[model samples]
Target: MVEGAWLWLTLFAIGSTTILTRGSFVLGGEGARLPPALQRALRYAPAAALSALIMPDLLLDAGAFDPANPKLVAGIVVALAAVRSRNPWLPFFAGMGVLLVLRKGLGW
Candidate 1:
């Protein structure tokens, strides 16, 4: 069992960290602006995050990459849909649809 003081200290630390981290944005009013370089760099954050989230799933299989994996093909379809549609959620649905069709209909 955790010691009472240690548990309380841990909870306090977590609460303080959460408040301080989130409070910065709240305290910075609507008109407050980040530096231009920071703003420009931040623009790639979503793309970077999406790649980080997706690349592993598309590329990896049983600890190795398989070029012929249906997931990779579905991912390609999703990428094309994203480029053509220029919409974020549409790519997700397109990927899901392709994955379903490949897995269920074509039995990939």
Candidate 2:
């Protein structure tokens, strides 16, 4: 019961932070304008965050990295496609396709 209490509190904290971080602008109304440089930098935050989340999975594992990890290779392929195509959602499918092909053909 005591251990579970901390887990519940942690979940609550995470949920609260997620809501607040995402909805802060909505809550603040239309009067705010961040400085241009800050806004430009902040625009990249999501991509930076996503890369941060992906890097460990791409680059590391329990023992070490496996360059043959299909996910990482697929991610690179998707990233390059996204760069070339400049379409937001297409890379997702490309990456998925890469992973599926690698998994099926190479058994990775």
**Highest lDDT scorer:** 1
For each candidate, give its TM-score against the true structure: 0.57, 0.58
Question: What tens digits encode model 1's per-residue C-alpha lDDT throughout 1-108?
Answer: 767999999889989978886786787777876799998998899899989998988998887977788899999998799789967799899899989999998998
Q: For model 1, how many clashes?
A: 0
lDDT of 2 by residue, 8-39 (tens): 99889889998897887888887986789998
Model 2 Cα displacement at 71 (Å)? 1.7
Model 1 / residue 36 / CA error / Å: 3.8
